[model samples]
Each structure stands twice: as C-alpha cells, then as structure tokens.
Target: MMDYVWFIRWFGPSDIYSTQLGELAHRVVKKLYGLGNKKRDPRQIGRRLRRVEWAKRAFDRRGIHTKRRRQQAVANKDDSITTHYHIGKSNKKRLDLKTYTHSRDPAAKGFWTKLQDHILGRLMQHEFDGDTHETFTDDDRKHIRIKDRKLVELQTLRVNYTTYDIRRDQDTINPRNHADVMMLSPEDEPGAHPYWYARVLRIFRVQVISTHPLASTVLSGPQEMEILWVRWLGVEPGYHSGFQRGRLPKVGFVDEADPFAFGFLAPAHIIRGCHLMPSFSDGRTAGLLQTSEPTAARKTDEIDDWQFFYVGIFVDRDMFMRYFPGGGVGHTANQGFFQSTPDNAENEPRGEESGDEEDELESDSEMHQTTMPPSQAQAEQPFAIDSDESVDGESSHDSDESFDSDPEGDDDLNETDVDDWQWDDGYGSA
Candidate 1:
C-alpha cells in the first residue's frame, strides 16, 4: 500500500500496459495447454508446469527491468542543467577544492560576495595595507606574536597547501587555539576589540599593501596581510545560519538580553581561516547531524581529514518562491485558507444537478399555480384580506363528511366539551 503511491508517481500509465500484457500471456498459456498432455506421467507434468511458471516469471522480470533502464536513461538525458541545486549537504569529494577546481560543472561562484551585498548592505572594502610576510621566505617575519603567549608560526607554503591543511590549521576544540582568537590580545581588547568572529571560508595570497592605519601615517615602512573572505557567525540565537557555539556571557544589568546579531560585515582584521562543520546542534552547542552512531564522516578515516565550508545563504524551492519577484504580492493576497470561487456568469464548469436547480424550481412553481383553481388562488392573495372584517368561520368547501374522512380530525376530539359529551349504552361515564 505504501508502494502504491510511489508506483503511481514513477510508473504513471505503465500499470495499464502491464495488466494488458499479463492478460495476453495468460491467454497464450491457456491456448498452449488445452488440457495439458493427457498421456504424460505425473512427475513429468509437474516439472513441465514448473518450467512454464519459471518462464512467465522471467518474462515479467525482464520486461520490468528493461522498462526501468529506459526510464533511467531518459531521465539522465533530459533533466535540465539550470535547475536550482540544493547545496546543503554533499559528500567530501564534491565539496573538495581540488575536485571543484578540475570540474567543468563549477559550484555556484561569488556566493559569499552576493550574500554580503544582500545581507550586509555594503561590499567589502579593498584596502591595500601591507602588514604580513611569508615566514618560509622571509626570515625577519617568521613568527607573529599574539596575546597570552600565543604565536602563529607560518611554516606551511601557501602555494602547495590544500583545503585540508587550511582547515586543520584553523579549527580546534580549545577556544584559545581557534584561528579567530590567534591574533587577539587581552590589551588590544578593552581598547579596539573585534566584535564579530567568522570562519575563513576562502583566502587569497595575492600581493597587496596592508599598512597599519595609524602607524602608516607616522612611519614609512609598509607591510602586507593575506586577504581572507569569511562567512560570519550569527550573533542572534535560533537562526539556522551558523554553527552554535556556547551562549555568550552576560555583560550588563539585563540578565536575559540575547547576544547581538553578528553576521553583518565591514573592514575588520581576519585572524582566522577555518572550516565550518555541518552538524545538528542543541540550543547552545554544536551536535551531530546523524542520529545513529558512526556517522559517514567517521566511517572513513579520510572523511575526518576532509574540510567543509558552508554559509546558510543557499535557498530551497520553497524559500525561493517566498522572495521571488512579483510572486509575493499574489501570495500575500491569497494568504488565507478560504478560496473565492468565480461567479457562474463567468462560465465556470458546474455539475449537472447544479444547472438544473433553477429550471426545477420554476417548474414546481408553475405546477403549484395550475393545480389551484382560479377562485382559490384569488382568495389566497394578500389583497383579498378585508381590513375591518374577521374571517374565522369554516369555509363553504368544509363539509361534515369531508371533515369526518380527514385523518387529522382526530386532533379535534375533546371529552371535556359539553356538546361532545356522550354516553355509551352500557357504561354511565362514556
């Protein structure tokens, strides 16, 4: 029964053809047998019958299999390339940078930029300030000192690095070791602290002048920093956009004021390049997406090494319909559950009985008019009633015999009336 609905969608009219073909097979089998060989032994007959059954089964199965193969081939050939692809979840190979770089069918490019323009209300400013140096190439800037005895040793070559290396270097269980916090210092904070945190979705190592805003004006030396594009973590709770870290600490008098919504962007120091793990979550912390143990990620040791990056910008079919141009007006107008049907004058299709209703009413009224005599019809009219006279007595048509014959005349019986009181011959009170 469950498969009935599934089959209807997949096969459509195939069942009809199948039934017809089956009937033909049955007829052919019947004609070939005719009373089945009367001279054959019992064991021979049984074997022969089994062979026939096997042939029938094989025929049906082969037909079904061929039909299915043709359907699949047609689907593969005819499906449109322009259909909006859902990028929510995919295998590691699909999301990998190396695989993506080689493929002719590219994933949606400029997603981060478009998302920034749409949600953040401004584009990312391209400032040329040189403050970075390659540790492997330049001996003067091998290690960058961070806050609380933390230091970033830039030993990995940017050119040879894969997506896996970037993610492994950034993401971590310890909050201190997180890429976003690597450049942060206790003194820098309480002065000009970074309010938002983001995972480095992408990084560009192109040459650019990344000078310190204040120090550049005073001194002549210019430094460079690697340009990083990041997907911001949301400050608001319950938005399905980003992975949930723990709740922010209460900072003010209000005990329950939620953290500020933090996905908006401007020119800020990007001290992190990290992977966003796609997972389910509790209200506070990140959780596993799978309900069963040994997730697909954990099933293979290689999967654990593969990194992923995702922002909740991609829209599904339903979400696209909501914000689609000119569609919202009609959607809002017809938002209610009630649907208004157009008038019959507009030539909408009606049931057979529905159109006959007016004709039936008119015919019944004409029959009623003809059944009554002219005098009776006239007496029943509203103008026939006299204004000053009372007409309470019985009409001329009311006869004693006619009254006695009426079944409802029994309702007029009253033993308490003096005129109606009568005695039976044998009973005194009758």
Candidate 2:
C-alpha cells in the first residue's frame, strides 16, 4: 500500500499518539536480545538492559532532545494558526517591479503589467455585497497605483484542506517541486467537471494600492495581498476520464496565445497539489503557441509543449475522493459542479465525445475561448476523439490499498519504459 508512504505525508499521522513508537520499541528489544549468546544467558541480558536504561535516564536528565522531538515542537507552533492554510519560508531579499519586468528570465516577462491589472481587479471588488461588486475596466485598470512596486517572492505554500473522510490533511506546494494544483470551479454548467487545474509558475505577496478616482471610498492605504501566477490547463477534448473508465483524466496546457492562459490565482482557493503525468504517446508539438517571441509560459528557447498529460487521480486517496460522486463529504461548496451523476449519464463531462447527432461537437481549440487559429493544430487528430490505444494498462492490485502495479507503495509503473524509450516515440505503461 502506498498508504504507508504518501498517505502519511498527505494526512500527517493517524493521530497525535501513534503506534510507531511501540513498534520501534520492539525493534530495539530485538537488537538487545542479540547481546545474549547461544546459551540464552537471561541474567546477562537483564544486566545489559538495566545498564542501557540507566544510560537513557542519565541522557534525559541532561535535557538534550532528539531530532524528532525538536520537529514536533515546531509543528505544534504551526498548529496554533487559526487559518486552514498559511504561507511558509522564502528568500529574505524582496524584488521590485524593475527587477522582475526587466529580468531576462522568461518567467518574469510581462509580469508587471499582469500584476497591475490583477491589483486593480481586487481593489474594485474590495467590500461589495452579493453580485454588486465593481469590476475592472480598461480605463479603471490604468489608474490603479501600487505602493513602491515592491513584491516578496515565496518558495513554499502549505495548504491544509479537508479530506474525503471528513478529516483535515495538508499539502505543501513549491514552484519547483509540487507545482500542479486543483481548485474548485464556480461554473454551473451541466455535466461540467468540478475543479480547475493549473501549474503554478510563480508565487508572490505584494502591497496593492488603488489610486483610481472613482474608488477613494474603498481604500485609505495600501493593502498587502497574496497571489499565485499560474499557467491554466484544460481537459483534453473527447477523453473518457472517470472511475468507470479506470483511466486518469487527460489535461493539456492551453494555447499560449489565449488571454487567460496565464493569470493570478488566489491561494485561498487552492484545494491541494495534484500529480500529472505526460501522455507520451501524444508526442510534443510547437503548434500550441507557434511563436518565437519570448514568453513566460514555457522554458527559455523551448519550442515544443507536451501534447497531453494525464491527471493521476489514483495517485492518492484524497484525490480520488475529490472526483468521485457522493464520495467527498467535505466538498459541499462544490456539490453541484461534479460530472453528470448516474441519474443523468446521458450528458457526459464537457469536452467528452458523444454519439448524439443533435449535440454540437467542440473542437480542441473551441474548448477554451481562444482566438488562436485551429489551422495550426494537428489536422490529423479529429475533434471527436476516441480512447487512444496508447493508454493500455490495468490496475493489477486486488485490494483497495493496492492502487497500482507496485506493491511497495511506490509509483514504479510510471517510471518504467524510460530506459528503452526514444524521444521520437510516446510513452505507455511499464
């Protein structure tokens, strides 16, 4: 079971008091038994145990603590924070607008302009009730002012979210480590998927000040705020991704030309980190953006993007619950946004292939409100796609805890096929 591994990281421990201490004690006793010879000298063993106990007592009297004990002390301090989530450590030196906007790194390109509009949007909706909040306009955004244009870049984000069992769990997201994330979607379309997926490109907390003449009543001073810069991902058109299919959902990066392709995200809206595997068989292509202009969306000088990626929903237990109907009790806020339930299976999740003649078919580019031309995309791949033979594999584990082919709780399957695979070919199950 991977439960012995990632599940522990996901939910912390089963309880404040755990059974590992007792098991470790037994292991120590077995080592002490080795001190006895073949004759099984009981008295000799007892004498050695007593001396060991004496040394332990003496060591404790000196007030020295083990690494585990010191870590627990720090964890206790973090538990006192009232919010379910909090930001963690980062670099000490802060970066200004000039450093970011003028940097040669592709990640920093156009960051200042996007951040300016983001601040204006937040300021416009500061204290409004219901749907009456003011929104950003072309004229309104230009008038917004920021204090000193200073920003603090963060390295880690610790998010504590409710699990499927109605318990709390935490996930740590880092831009370089665990960047993929999921968030609740507010859309109410029928047969719509419940969550929005994105990969965090950068993280920041800046002081926002609005100097718009029409918004003087909204603020008196600068307001400190936190936001995540993310590259939005969309589900593959006409892919069957559900528990019934036993295959993970496929998602891909939107065409870089799309306006909302990259935007600021509120950390408060994040659910947890997600695991996405590249669908190697689909191959890489440069048609998505097809631009030589410098972009923050992709790595420097990188001309191609992965054709598709699979959302590994089965990677962890909590992730599975998030997608299953009537399976997540804590996801009440998004109760109505899940895929079509059993009662209404006729309408599959948006972007899924349908056989009905009346239903309008959505092409890959049509899935997102993008102005990018479809003429540049793969003309061979039809809009009404069927399950690709590339994803041919079955879950070999028999038990619920046995999630994958590996029994040691490691994702050995995904790591397979890399040795003999060539860059020209796509990947399949190991």
Candidate 3:
C-alpha cells in the first residue's frame, strides 16, 4: 500500500499525481507480486531509491519544482490569464494591441505625444510663415568654411577734388592752394572746361594714412601737390597810371597775397606785377574767340602779330648767404620788407643792405646768376607820347572850371555844365 503522505510528497498536486502514477506504472515490472513480502533485494531497492534521488536533485538544480510547475501549468491551462485592455483609438476606431499597451502606460504616452506635437508644430510654422530654417545659405555656408579667404580686396572708386592747409609756427607756410586739376562748368555750359589760370597757391605731399569713402586719392600720402586760393580782385582807377601809360588807368592783381604775410617770394611778386585790366568787352565775344572758328576774316593790312612777356626777380645765393650766413631755411631778402610799410623804409636797414664788401666777397667766390631767363623779361618801355606839349594840353584844357572859379560861382552851374565836363579830365571826369 502506498503511504498517502509519501505519495503527496513525491508527486505534487492531484493532476501531477495522476500523470506520475501512469509513468511509474510503465516503468515498473509485474514481478512485484507479493507487495508486502515479495519486496525486492535491499541493494536493488537502495539502487532504485538512489536513482529517484538523483532525478529529484537534477530537477531541483534546474529550478523546476513540481509544485511551482503545476501551479504555472494550471494558471496557463486555459485562456483565462490572457486578458485584453482598451487603448487609444486606431484608424477603424478599434484599439491596436501595441498602441493600447503604450497608451495605457502614461509615462510612455506623454513622452511620445509631446515629441510628435512639437515636431508637427514646427513643420507647420515653417510652411505657413515661410521662415528660413538654415542660418546661412548653401553658398555662403560653404564660403565661410573655406580655408583660403581674402580679408580685404582692392577696388577703384570716385572722389572729389578738395584742398587742405599746411601751417608752421602759427603762420600759414602753405596758404590756400588747389589740386592741379579740377573740372567746372558754368550753369549754362554744355561741357566742363579746364580753368588754367586758376592759380595753385600752395602744395603738400601727404600719405593717405586712412580714408573714408569720398576722400580724394590725390591726398593719400605725404607727397607734394599744389593747392589754389579762390578769391576775387578789386581794381581801382589811377593805381596803374605810372607804369603802363595813362591808358591803363585801372588795374588789379586777380591773384594777390596779403602784404603782411610771408608769401612765395618769387611767384607772388610776379603775379603782383602782372596787373589785369578787365576788358569792357562782352564775355560772349571772348568766348567766341575760344571756339574753333572765327566770325570775321582779317584784312591784308591787319596784322595778327601779338607779343607776350614776363618779368621776374631772382635772388643770388650770395645775397641769401650775406643776409643769412648760417644758411637757415626760408631765407628771403623781402622778408624784412614785409614787416613794415614802405613809408617807414628809412626806419631799418631792410634785411641788411647789399654791401659793396659783400659784392666783392661774391666776386671772389664763384658767382652764379639767379635771375630767370631773359625771355621772361617784361617790356617796360615808357609809354609813347607825341610830345610833352600834348600831355600839357590834355591836363590843362581838361581841367574843370571849378578849379579856376572863385567861391562865388559854386551854385550857378546847371545840368549843361555837368554834361560839358563829361568827356575827360582824368579819373571819374567822364
């Protein structure tokens, strides 16, 4: 007889017990005839017990206990453990198994949904607003990444002609001057013309240390160039009477220097001597002469000859050495003369009077002529006069009767007297 407790210990539950009973029967021999007394030999029985123990040990080592396996088998025996739960809706309004599991897990659902919404929102905003997603264009991005790139490039640009000053010792060493060339046109003129007589009053050479856009390149360095002074000249009658005959009763130097300033010793004086007498002729007439064709032909008797002349003073080195023996820069014979008026000429020895001793010294030394070529000599011949008698006639007869009248006739002169006196006497008489 099987001990029930032993059977329960060996086999596990009712279901396993039935299966084990069947398997045990298959392996048992029928010779177990007299169950009580016909027991097998102790050694054989021991061997069988040992075999069962080894089998139990093997099963234990594999972590497969009959009780737990029975419980698992029973639990999974039917479809009862395989339960279903609803999740998010699918295309057909039915819950998808994978998505249902994911949706049921709140953590996973929140993460995925938030990420999806953010991506979709960004895409929509890009499409609707037409915003650029890239910071740089394709070409620009590649250009920035290139290893060899120039930091700056050279280019040509336009600039205006302008002027600047150079001064020393509180004195304008180089006074108002002009750039060599500038283009100008009158309001009505069709094209620009070069004004040649526009004097360059001073010049400088400077390096263009730096620049802003519109500055001229002509002044870009410490280099020399001429500048011009722009001003008008005032002509007064009787100022030029002694030099060019009374015919030039009016005169002016269009380009004049302040008598008080230390001007360019040579050029300034030349300009001062070349007095300009404005022609009463129309500017249109003068402009016609500048054109290619002339309106009139000259008679055989009419000569086209014209004369040009210039006069300039040159100071010899000896003169400069005598006055400035130490040989300093900017030595000028007329420098002292500029400090005082001509009326005070006797007040001081005008820059050390040229002495005979100095002349002798210069003669001993190699003397050199400092004067410019004689071709520049101005024709200064005295004005041609028919006679001294004509001069007297012009002067005496042309005098106003007022000069000869007594104090009694001052109020009696009428409009006729004024008209009669208008032809000529001297300045303002006509």
Q: Which candidate achieves the best TM-score against the true structure? A: 2
lDDT per residue, candidate 3, 300-416, as tens digits? 342221111111111222222312212223322332322323443334342343455566856533221112123322321121111112334332323321211111000111111
Query: Which order, best to worst by lDDT?
Result: 2, 1, 3
Would you give me the overall lDDT of model 1? 0.27
Q: Which regions of candidate 1 fall more than 4 Å away from where they truly are?
A: 1-108, 111-194, 208-225, 238-268, 271-430
Candidate order, TM-score descending: 2, 1, 3
Q: In order, what lDDT does every prediction score?
A: 0.27, 0.60, 0.24
lDDT of 2 by residue, 1-430 (tens): 2234455674576654566456655554565577678366667766766776665556568855443343335555756644655664343547776876787744455566667666655655553111122355557766765567777777667677877656677776777657889887666676566677888877777777766875542456777777888888897876655654445778998775666667777787788889989999999987776666666566666777888899887776677776766556566435553445555445555343344422343442243223223442344122211221223542222323212212100011111111221111211111
Task: Report model 1's TM-score to 2 decimal places.
Answer: 0.18
Q: Which 10-residue span in candidate 3 carries the lowest summed lDDT?
A: 403-412
Residue ranges of candidate 3 with Cα displaced over 4 Å: 1-224, 229-244, 249-277, 281-430
Q: Write the per-residue lDDT of candidate 1 for residues 28-71, one digit (tens) a residue.
A: 44443554675555555556556655654575577533332343
Pick by TM-score: 1 or 2, better one? 2
What lDDT score goes with residue 190 in model 1?
A: 21
How far is each candidate from the true structure, as Cα RMSD in Å? 34.1, 16.7, 58.6
